[model samples]
Target chain A: MDVSEQIHAELKKCGVRLAASLPDDWVAPLIRRLDADNDIRHVPVGRESEAVMVASGAFFGGVRSVAVIGNTGLLTCTGELATLNLRHQIPVFCIVSMRGSIDDHQIYQEVQGRRTIPVLQAYDFPYRVIDRPEEIGCIPDAYQWCRLQKRPFILFLTRALLKGRRWS
Target chain B: MIAKEAIRVLAAHRGDAIAVCALGVAANEWWDATKAEDCFQMHGAMGFAASFALGLALSLPNVNIWIINSDGSLCMNPGCLLTEAAQAPRNLKHFVIDNQVYQTVGAVPMVNAGRTDYAGLARAAGIASTHTIDNVPEMEKQLPRLIAGPGPTFVVLRVEPDPSHINTPPVTYEGPEMKYRFGRALEKRFGISVFNSSGY
Candidate 1:
């Protein structure tokens, strides 16, 4: 099976009934897989913040959901994550692309690589970087931990994890 | 029409439907009118109430979901209409309370103020059923049908901006309390657990 398929199976184990996504290249395959699944209701949002909000709402509805977006998109939605998830203590798990990493040669993504973790730390949002296929099995535990934490938790997919090789 | 009165009228007709209210006037008014635990009032993320409601609607499928949005909030994230339209949850109804100004911040004029056509925007976003109601009577008259109709339907409620409303304040409970109340309320209503045994 493909890496996206493996991740999809893990998400299924999480019992994620809904997924709201705004795609970034690294996570696009996973988003497409989620969209194709009949069991997981896929919502394609215009903005990354909408995915965060949608996932938060799903939490209240007793639905497990994940937001699939890029690192840049994650940066754009910190304010929403803070005020909505942090203030209200709402748990939302997000699967974000780990862009701007050493292996990611895209110039536009460098800033995101440099800034994403610090920003998450500054906001006290927990995150886990999964750089290998073996790490994908931890998704269900991460999902449960996100619910336990009662705030936004980021599960980052590195280029190596997605493509099975370094871009560099 | 008075915004409060309009909200009151809308409140009277809301049966078992869940509400996701945007920040400022509409959310405050919703709390003032209903004191509903099942309703989730936003404190931040000004524009994403519609998105949140759409998620809820998709998840519940059997329950009606209403978003009490605002003109300012709508402008903050107009693209929500596109997302909502694409999903087209039949259980979702979107209501934009257009007061023509930022009423919570002492009634500052809205950008493009009276010229922006919100309902038209929703229609262009692929929502076939849309209405702009300028009075309480029209709101009362149209709500039943709109609620009954398939969504994502959009309705714009136009009202004069009242600076006095700024002083009215939001609901008494703060953020975390609001979460527990809302989550617990939903759990009781739907017989589904929103939290774990340890209550995270």
Candidate 2:
């Protein structure tokens, strides 16, 4: 199976009934996979913060959820994540693209590569990067861990995991 | 109309609807009016309560959801309207308390000074049923229909700034306690489990 399919299966195993996303190139396939699923409710939001807030809301309704977005988008929503999820102690699982990695030659993503982990660390938000398809299975455990942590947790998909394909 | 009075009116007709309130005045007023555990009154995240409510509405599908968003909060993220519009959950109702100022912080004037047409913005964002009410009587008159109608509805309640309630305290519970209270309330109300066996 493809990495996207593997990731989708893991999300299902994690009991994610809802997914809110604003896609970047790397996470787009997974977003499409979630969008096509009938059982999992997929919400396409205007901004990354909306996805984070939406997932936070789903927790109150007894639904497990995930927010999917790009690394840059992840930076945009940190304040919301800190204030809403951290302050309220609501756990939201986010799947993000690990932009600006060594393989990522995009100039726009360079700042994110160096700064993202430090930002998450400063906020005490937990995160793990999945660079290979085999690590996708860890999502269920991460999801549960986020729930236990009662805060925002991020599962980042690295360039290596989503590479080997050409979009243009 | 006063915010408390408007909230009281909304609470009276609330029925089974679950509410998510934005931080500050909207949340504080709702807590004061209803003292409801089912409602999640946000202490932070000033702008995204609308998105939060939409998520809950989409997830539950059977439960009614209301968002009490204030003008200052709405201005912080007006793009939420487009997201709400796109989902168009029939169970969600959006309300904005337009006091023309940040009520919690000593009545500082809002970014656009309350001249921004929020209902018009909602309508423009594709929410077909949008209403703006400026009085308690009008809210009372229209709330029954608003509650009964299929939603993704938007309502703007325009009220005068009340300096007296500016420093009103927030709800009793906050942080994790507030989280469990709201979640457990929903679980009890709907017979669903928000926490796992070990009690998250």
Candidate 3:
């Protein structure tokens, strides 16, 4: 299965009934796939923070949710993630495209690649980078650990895993 | 109308709606008016209360979700209107307490004060049912229609800022306690487990 398909399968296993997203090219395929699924309610938000807030609210409704966005989008929503999810101890599962990696080669994304992990570390938000399709299976475990942690946890999808020919 | 009085009217007519309140004045007023645990009083994420409420509404399809937003908070993320319009959740109602000032921060005047057309903005964003209530009587008159109407409906409640508002503070509990209280309240109300067996 493709990386998107593999991730989708794991999300289903995690019982993610709702997904809120602001798409970046790297994660767009996965967003589109989830958007087409009937079981997962896809909310296409205007801003990245809206995706974070929506997923936080879904937790209150007793629904498992995930926020899908690109790395820059993830950077933009740190305030909301900290103040809303962190302050309230509300666990929000976020799947972010790992932008600005060596192969990503985008000048606009360079700052994010260097700063994202440090910022997340400053906030004490746990995250993991999935560099291969085989690592996609850990998503369900990550989701469960996020719930147990009771705070925002990010699962980063590298361009390598997403665009890797092995998946095709 | 005073913001508190307008909130009282809304609280009275809230029915079975689960309310999501933005931080600051709107949240304080709702807390004072309703003192209800079913409401999720946001401590931060100034503008996304509307989005949060939309998610809750979508998840709890049978429940009514109300977002008590503020002008300051709304302007912080007006794009929320576009998202809300796109979702068009019939069970979600958005109320913006437009006092034209950030009352929490010593009544700082809002940017473009008294000029922004929030109702028109919501309409332009594709929410067909929208209204602005400038007084208590007007709000009372429109409450039934607004309450019974299918959403996403946008209502802007124009009210006077309380110069004496320093006396009114937010709900006392802070941080994680608020989460547990609100989550446990929902769990009891809907018979759903908002927490795990370990009580996260």
lDDT leader:
3
Clashing pairs in 1: none
TM-score of each: 0.98, 0.97, 0.98
Model 2 complex DockQ against the native: 0.82
Candidate 2: which stretches are off by over 4 Å? Answer: A165-168
What does candidate 2's lDDT look like per residue over B23-130, in tens digits? Answer: 887688788888899998877777888888888998888999999999998898899999988988999999998999987778889988857899999999999999
- Give each model's clash number: 0, 0, 0
Write one digit per residue (lDDT tens) for candidate 1, span A1-168. 889999999999999999999989778999999999999999999899999999988888899999999999999999999988998999999999999988899999999999899999999999999988888899999998898899999999998888668444
Model 1 chain B TM at: 0.97
- Residue A139 C-alpha lDDT in model 2: 92
lDDT of 3 by residue, B1-200 (tens): 88888989999999999999999877887888888988899999988888889889988988999999999999999999999898889999999999999887889899999999999999999999999999988888999988998988899999887876667788988889899998999999999988889998
DockQ of each: 0.86, 0.82, 0.86
lDDT of 3 by residue, A1-168 (tens): 788998999999999999999999989999999999999999999899999999988899999999999999999999999898989899999999999887887899999999999999999999999998878889989999999999999999998888753334
| Cα misplacement distance, residue B113 of candidate 1 (Å) | 0.5
For residues B1-200, could you state the per-residue lDDT of candidate 1 as single tens digits? Answer: 86887788889988988998999988888899999988989888888888788888888888888899999999999999999889888888888899999887778899999999999999999999999998877777888888888877898988888776776679888999999998899999889888889888
Candidate 1 displacement at residue A88 in angstroms: 0.3
DockQ score of candidate 1? 0.86
lDDT of 2 at B23: 87
